[model samples]
Structure formats: structure tokens, C-alpha cells
Target: MELTDLAPLARSSIGFDRLLKLLEGSRLPEPADDYPPYNIEKTGQDAYRITLAVAGFGPDDLDIILQPNLLAVSGKKADSEARGKGFLYQGMIQRPFRRVFHLADYVQVRGAELKDGMLVIDLAREIPDAMKPRRIEIAGGQARPAQIDTGHGG
Candidate 1:
């Protein structure tokens, strides 16, 4: 869909005004996202884990990609393995898939490992020094912040 096609949907929600403003006028065509199923878990205070079900995809067939605040995991079967004779009914969900995740500020992908057909993606929240609360240095006695009333009555 074109950018204009999504304009009407943004106006339907009152709370979405802030998000719409943040997105500005830039638009990305809707993508036909893949679905093989996944799970996101809060592993620690500042850690998270994303587990994707990739039953037939091995470690070499998967790729973890990070783009600014977006993380994507894509997988494809390793060149159709030569099956032995008498093998039939490929029932496993072995198709290629790509999954995307939107990350918050300071969030970083720490590690990724595949085990038993499950792809685990580790994430950690990196609190920037500027954004973290720091104790203010008091030079003996610090002056209070000033509040200026710039409005003048006529």
C-alpha cells in the first residue's frame, strides 16, 4: 500500500496521535511479515530473550540482523538435503521465514544461539550515562534552580 493508504487508519485512534507525530510523514509500505511463531521473555532486570521456532533450520541457515532500533531474524533451509529413498510427507514447518522486532532506545542484541530447533536471541538494555540518574554535585551549598516568569502584563 502507498503512504496515503495508511493515513486514514492513523486518525482512527486518539492515543495514536503521538505515535503518528513521531513517525512524521515518512511511510514504509506494509510488509507481508513471515510467521513461524516466536516468544519474547524478560530474562533479567535489563535482559530479554526472543525464541523463534525454526524446526528445520540449523545454525548455519539462520541469520540475525540488527538495524538501528530494529532486529530481524531470517532463516532458510540449507539447499534441500538429499533425502534417502522412501522418505515422504515433509510435515515439519521447514519453510524459510523472517521475523522482525522493534527495540527501544539503548537496547542491544547481546547474543544468539540455536539449540534443538529453537533460535534464541539475547538482548540487553544499555542504559546510557546521560540518561541514567546521577547525583548532582553540590559545591558547599548549591543554589536552587530559578524559574523565570517571562510573561509581561500589559
Candidate 2:
């Protein structure tokens, strides 16, 4: 299903303007550009993991960048390594690729690692103490009236 209009939902929401904007501006990846398949999984209540199948990419050939609320993962084979390698089938893709992910508020990149031909990226949402829910202590019992002190030695 496709979402065409979000104006009605945006008008009724209070603090979801950013979310609505993001949804409206979101675009699916091109069907023909499905290279280096990836998976995103929720590991914990506030933790997430993104695993990409980078079969021919090494640690030095990949770069993970985090900026504001964006995460970009890119990989490119070295010119020296790609040259003089005449393959019979050439099934493995060694071309440069860049993938970007939009992160939610307070979500941060914890770390990343390349293991078993998979690039694993770890993320966690850490809400600040000031933004967390807190109980308000309500004062009970009798109320006291304050006396007003006027000027002119009153």
C-alpha cells in the first residue's frame, strides 16, 4: 500500500510534524539497485542492528559515517586490488556503493564491525534524563495564607 496524502493526519497531530514530514518525504529504494542486501533488526528495547551482506568488502574498503540524524555506509574496492584480476565468472560485485539511513531522535551509532562477510552496525536510543517521564510530588494538607506587606511602613 502507498501513502498518498498525510495532510489530514498532520493537521490532527500535535508533536508528530517531523514524523509526518519524514514519512511524506520517504522513498523506497529502486528495484534495480538492490545491491548488497541488508537487514535491520531490533535487538533490544532501545537497541537496533543493521547487517549488510558485504561479501567482497574489507574493513578498509568500507566507511560508516554518522551525521546529525543520518547514517551513511559506503564501500569501494581499491583500484590496485581490482586491476589485473581477470575472473572467469565475475559474479562478485566490487563496485562502489553508498547506503544511507535516517535515524530517529536520540538514536546514536554505538559501533560497527565486519564479521563473516557481513557489516554489522549497532545503534541505541538514549533519551536524556530531562526528557524522561518523572513523577511530580504534590503537596498535601492545610493551605497557608500569606500576608501582604505594603510600603510606607505598613
Using lDDT as the measure, which candidate wins?
Answer: 2
* Candidate 2 worst ten-residue window by lDDT: 25-34
Per-residue lDDT of candidate 1, residues 112-136 (tens digit)? 9888878888999998889999999
**What's the residue-level lDDT of 149 in candidate 2?**
81
For residue 121, model 2's alpha carbon misses the true position, in angstroms, by 1.0
| Tens-place lDDT digits, model 2, residues 6-120 | 7788878899877887787775444578677899999999999999999989999999999878999999999988886877778788789999889998999999999989999
Q: Model 1: how far is 20 from its true place, Å?
A: 4.0
Displacement of the residue 57 alpha carbon in candidate 2, Å = 0.7
Candidate 1 C-alpha error for residue 95, in Å: 1.1
Q: In model 2, which runs have C-alpha deviations exceeding 4 angstroms?
A: 1-4, 8-17, 27-32, 146-153
